[model samples]
Target chain A: MRVVKKAEDRKNEILDAVDELFGQKGFDGTSTNDILEKVGIARGTLYHHFKSKEDIMDALIDRYAVRLIDGAQEVAADKSIPIVERIIRVVMALNLSGGSSEQIMEHIHKPQNALMHQKIQKVIINGVPPILTEIIREGIQQGLFSTPFPYECMEMVVIYASTVFDDDLVVMTEKERSSRIVAFVCNVERLLGAESGSLMDVMGMFGEGDESSRD
Target chain B: MRVVKKAEDRKNEILDAVDELFGQKGFDGTSTNDILEKVGIARGTLYHHFKSKEDIMDALIDRYAVRLIDGAQEVAADKSIPIVERIIRVVMALNLSGGSSEQIMEHIHKPQNALMHQKIQKVIINGVPPILTEIIREGIQQGLFSTPFPYECMEMVVIYASTVFDDDLVVMTEKERSSRIVAFVCNVERLLGAESGSLMDVMGMFGEGDESSRD
Candidate 1:
């Protein structure tokens, strides 16, 4: 007697194993056999789903892209969530704080995942602005935002922020970092056509240290 | 007569040559001979400056680190510039729009430079906060910023801005990007202890499209 794994289920198991191994040993360091060993599948079964190591990596990347887009898409579909909260949730969904997310992020950042990293960036650059545009549109309709070129404004804002404020790009001392956050938050209202200085209540109120203010 | 390049001068020349060649053709693509040929130096001359190709990369990275720190340090020394303006200048210095900035950035982001990228991140984390901290101290002296734990505030702020706002990490929809800029500008006054959102004017007005004139 033997267990017969469905094609989709078996493919997911292989992908999950590959994702974990890639995260642990990096794309270059891992081999097909390692993936096979982790998933305990036959060579035929492995090749049946993926053509090569790179193919597996591609599948893994595709999985991440789908999950990421799906997360944002779900938020976009939900009408009950406030625009600001939805924006935050959408961004937070992109972050890897729980469950398999840490593993996924670690795998993607590995040196061999350079292409994968760039691919993810491409998805972000091409995909994100439109989603945010919709949120901005909703805000505009609800009188929550007042921008004439909501989409263009968001584009410039996103480009500047995604590049310069990236921790990976520029390092700031504590004072500089705080000032930037303050500066960044203050500017958001204007970007959205809201009154200037209207969003200051949450500037420094974002991290775990601010637990005292949770109400 | 044979050219007699001084050791330090030759060392700088080799590093510069490595920077250009590496910029044009990434680490894997450029050979040692290519570096020697372009620099018009012999293999012996190249070795005298650096132990190997990787060594040349290391020297170039060290040079970039120094240049980067120098940019931040210059602003730190100028006590007269308004703190927010100084921060803007510092960001401006890092614009990567001219001279060696673009070359350095491309080279650093090449696949082989993943570790180098991480090194730059560490440098930013270690270096930038204190530079901004000095401004905060000044702001405090002038009764502008009010934070009991300025250091922690700065740390979280830097981590968020550098990471989240980083174009490399999170792609932005145009609307999202604009909102970020607006938020940043509006929050600075709050972070600095000025009247909440006093520095809001800088948003959408700062940073130049200064690339066309650069060589």
Candidate 2:
């Protein structure tokens, strides 16, 4: 029984390693040999955990989707927190700044991964509404929001925010970027029917990456 | 003299054809033969306008950057218009809804054209500020705004709005999207020192494609 448990643990470890590597190197760029080399496990052991590279990618995407949804859900359930704060938290949760999210984004942006990008976007669109809808309901109950269609509103906002504000989409100086943040948050507050100037803190979340990391 | 003018016209026609075809099929999928087919021009004629397929793409990117700047500059010059209204117009000018802008966006988004996308973004970042800055400067001059960093503020507003409000990122239902628009304009008004609700006219722009085209 202990041996079986240990095997499952190793499988998960392998999955995480594969996810990060695949995200960074891309599927075509990465080889099965690279996986084995990085994990330093025998080829047979690697195959035992995942049937093939495709299978591993499938598992990684699934895990990524689930974690993304769960993180947002956790924020949704925390009723004690204010709705505006909750909104920021939910968006920040999906940001994927570090961890496996960066790898996933990098992978999705690759040319061959266009279909994958569309599907993940679909999932985000479908996944976010329900979670945001609940908080919107709370905000309505508290009389902080006045939106008639919460789910639809969330869908539009998410689509716009994710695509346009994406650093990959448009790059600007920090001075200009910060102003854009203020403008964005200003609009978001009104979308939720909150008072103007709410959600200001979101601007701070757009951090400056360590310059050394890039160069 | 007429012969020279006609030759110049032929060259312009070839460049236009390349832009349209490359935008639709992308850099890799498009070929010189395809360009010849579209323009009904001979091989020698195509080469005269552009040295290679790569040259065609570069020229197309250059055209796109110029168009983007021209549109933004047009919006900036209209000092009588409200800041929020001017901002919406600037964003609309950048959108790839139809015409030359659409061609530009499609060309940049192509996988092989990643460098093109980066270049265009860099241009927007560098060039857009002065336009938005002019608006902020006008607002401050009129005592309608009070930001110390007009340029930076407008740059942030432009970047955030351009990305978050952009349709290509995430597709949302109309209701969700509009609420976001209202929210965005409202928040931006505050950032610019305009009274809350003063920027409501900007929300009308969202309804432009959503309600009108559907009708």
Candidate 3:
């Protein structure tokens, strides 16, 4: 008997294949034929799912955005984790490393795909602050934060982090990057009205372990 | 005596005309012919100074960059102003409002002029940070800032402020903008280790004077 796959599953499989191909070959370097060949899907089946290669890329971006948002939301909503740790965990969860999302970011950062870059930035700028704002509000309830402008505070933080630390936007030496991360966490603690050195633990997430190493 | 304008003076006149044209018609909409007619210069004279319309725009950007850097440098170097006040003053001087710089920024921000927008961003990313870093170093000397990463901190500040507060990058409501200004000043204070509420006065330069006006 012949086996059949669900429509959603087949679509997701195509996205997964394309995601890997994009990460490896970049968006420009990868063609629809490459995606079709990798997925072993007939041209008609691929066309049934996506109108064009750009359409597939758009879907991939949506998938990546959803994945990131879900990961962040999961960490933020977990009542079991300490709020401080949750904050750090939520940020860590959003870190793009060795993933298809990381690959997509790398691909779009290239000069040719500026439109793609802008689209991704729009998603982050609009989608992220609200996700982070929820965590800030939780921190406020827990007496960990005391800002009147919780959403706005998170907006600035998101914009700063999304742009400054965005490898595509601002290039920095590793040492320069490490220092910014330390500075970022220190100011973030103050921004939320938390204790001076409370969030310093996040340094290890960026690979600079311990405060003593900073000096 | 025959009228003989200095090369620099003639260059300035062409730039001034093109600046007005760009402000009025945008970079793409304003043609080289428009510049020639507006400047009342022959095509030969216009070509002598700038190879093309894009070249003129690049030159205008350079001039604007110099003007902003010079303005900020003057404020930063003045010993008469208090160090904290100097930081505020230097930022205020760089504010893009009601000038050729503002017009140029608006023109470049149009969707069709993404290249121009990127070029201007490169100028800011490369140029503005050092000028602001000098003020930050001064702040460190005055005991106003205690951060070890003064230059990097300033880089973060400039990047955040340049993008978040940039009128073109992110569209915001009046109320939204007012709140962001408060959050920005608050975070910047912490970023430099300045006391909370010390830099709140910078809000006035943004025309939102006094935090009390924020609802």
Q: Which candidate is the best by TM-score?
A: 3
Q: Write the per-residue lDDT of candidate 3 for residues A1-215, one digit (tens) a residue.
A: 43368989999999999877876766667888898889887888899888887788789889877877776777778889777777766655544342234544555555444445555666777777788888788888988787777776676677677666663556788787777778788767766778777778644643533234566
Winning model by DockQ: 3
- Give the per-residue lDDT of model 1 (tens digit) for B12-112: 88887777877777766789999889888788878876788767766777888788778777876897887766765565454333323444565565544
Question: What is each candidate's DockQ, to 2 decimals?
Answer: 0.12, 0.10, 0.32
What lDDT tens digits, residue by residue, belong to model 1 across residues A1-215?
Answer: 45688889989999888878877777767888888788887788899988887788778888887777777778777889867666645554554232234445545654455555655655655566678789889988988777666665455445445434432445467676557656655556645656555555433333333333554
User: Which scores better on DockQ, 1 or 3?
Assistant: 3
lDDT comparing candidate 1 with the true structure: 0.63
Ranking by DockQ: 3, 1, 2
Candidate 3 scores an iRMS of: 2.1
Off by over 4 Å in 1: A1-17, A31-56, A96-103, A106-115, A145-215, B1-17, B30-59, B79-86, B98-103, B106-115, B132-215
TM-score of chain B of each: 0.77, 0.75, 0.82
Query: Lowest summed lDDT over 10 consecutive residues: which window, candidate 2 chain A?
Result: A203-212
When 1 and 2 are scored with TM-score, the better candidate is: 1
Q: Taking chain A of candidate 1, what TM-score results?
A: 0.76
lDDT scores in order: 0.63, 0.65, 0.70
In model 1, what is the error at residue B138, expressed in angstroms? 4.8
Best by lDDT: 3
Question: Model 1 misses residue A134 by how many Å?
Answer: 2.2
